[model samples]
Target chain A: MEEIIKRAYLESLDGRRFGDKKEEVEKIREKILSAKKIVVATNNQKKFNIIKDIISKICNATITMIDIDTRFADLTRVPALNKGLMALDTETADLVIARGRLGVPGSGSMLVILDGKGRILTASLSPSSIVHRENIEDRIKKEIIEALSRIGINLEKY
Target chain B: MEEIIKRAYLESLDGRRFGDKKEEVEKIREKILSAKKIVVATNNQKKFNIIKDIISKICNATITMIDIDTRFADLTRVPALNKGLMALDTETADLVIARGRLGVPGSGSMLVILDGKGRILTASLSPSSIVHRENIEDRIKKEIIEALSRIGINLEKY
Candidate 1:
């Protein structure tokens, strides 16, 4: 029997791999054992700014950004306008993230997350339809908790 | 001297060209002329619903949609997805309408228009971005406009 291989996309701004060599992930994993803060990467000014703004008020962490093509080319020949794939692909991020907009009476986008290795840790494709709606911060926090659990990262201290 | 031959993508929904077989574009042109409202198609269901809700307050044609695949398969490939193409050719579309999102901000999608006999009329890639936030809608509108103009269709009515 053959094992199925899957590649997960991480969000980063430094480069496609989020400035981490394979050795770096090992060191970071050790820090997670007792560290108060976690460092993660995302793509673009718009995306980084959005994530940083939200995460700052929750738990504290240094949100470093890197430049990379979060868009997965292998999924299809065409590139996805959505940024979730990019955020999840290259970084040492405990979780990848994205944000969408709100419009009309019942139209809006969602914030999605992927794990460090390019797997979709958790996702919200279509969230509530309100511009800058309340509880968005809380919702994201909850999703992060669930995603980390799936990846076997415990956030009990923070 | 031989004239430069251009190419394009023609789109239809559920295999129905917008107009009659003898004069394919006339049906769509007529619809536009009689339409009091127009709603652009998008993958966002919320947006679609909102647009539909507001149609009565807006234009008169009511809301009609066409699905686009930014990843719409290349005509030469197996398992063709082009509705217009099938009507004209076991080979190609009058104009290839792009369906999915293009990754680049201002790079847009493509359209290949064909004559009645499946001859290539004109082919053009749409602008990837709109003047507003560079998203999928802007790209599709830009491509549709260019494709229509090349075919000598008046767009102000649309």
Candidate 2:
């Protein structure tokens, strides 16, 4: 898992410069394949449910949703608790996936995956045009699969 | 401004335990007052506009909206670029205010203000109920003033 995450980080760095969504997704998919336990961190239950549902359908990994504020209520007062530190403190998960408000109305969201050490493995801003489509669930699912395929994860087998 | 940010950071550590909205706002208000130049960082243009509008109404500080991806397109490929490092690299601003997707369907937003050093001075998860009100613009304006007042800022003068 660590090796996969390191490779993902390296690939993500290369992909981000060119804004290559395919490469970014491919790297993340590789990390996801090696991850046995994952935590989806967010304050909104709705977003959590959607993400949890989607991940479950594609992988056999153990998934959990953590309410950011609830889990870090104590740290909220800690002045040094930046996003990375907050994420790093989640010791239970090999991978931490966090969702935040994109400030855009109707679709489009930022998906960031962090390793146990709080290193950002991959981040992507989902295009609103596609996210705002009628079948958002299906679209998201398809995107996830396509991205994962680059890393050799066949959703059909899962 | 450094002193104000320090004081706000200290106060934030105290108020986070109880989730005190007023205290959180007050600390941010102080931070804002001391900030000469501020950068509002986010990928979504709509979110940037709203935040820019709100901050402009309350203070005379120089504000700029930075599209996170545009500025860090090259760094995005860098594996070491965590959220803190990303905010820190914006050398133009004494302070960087960032907005993330809250995963909520509408209204509610998470606001985080980080000092030049990337220390989160203050953070707030605005309540959705208040955010989703009919007159959102007016409500946001009012809320900004009210929160600032806790820190002794008379928005009426600004």
Candidate lDDT scores, in order, read 0.40, 0.48
Q: For candidate 1 chain A, which ten residues in a row score worst on lDDT? A: A1-10
**lDDT of candidate 1 over B49-103, digit per residue (tens):** 5434433332354454345432333221211223333333332322222233223
Candidate 1 Cα deviation (angstroms), residue A139: 4.8
Model 2: per-residue Cα lDDT over A63-143, one tens digit each: 876545533323332211233345557547877766432211211334555666564554333333322333645544554
Residue B43 in candidate 2, Cα distance off native in Å? 16
Worst 10-residue stretch by lDDT in candidate 1 chain B? Answer: B1-10
Candidate 1 lDDT by residue in tens digits, A70-139? 4322122212213444444334565445544322224444444444554433444345535546575465
Evaluated against the true structure, the overall lDDT of model 1 is: 0.40
Report the error of model 2 at residue B125, Å: 14
Q: Please name the candidate that would achieve the greatest lDDT relative to the true structure.
A: 2
The digit string of per-residue lDDT tens for model 2 on B81-147 reads: 2333465585577777664322211113334556666654433333333223345445444544443
The per-prediction CA RMSD against the true structure, in angstroms, equals 16.2, 12.5
Interface RMSD of 1: 10.2
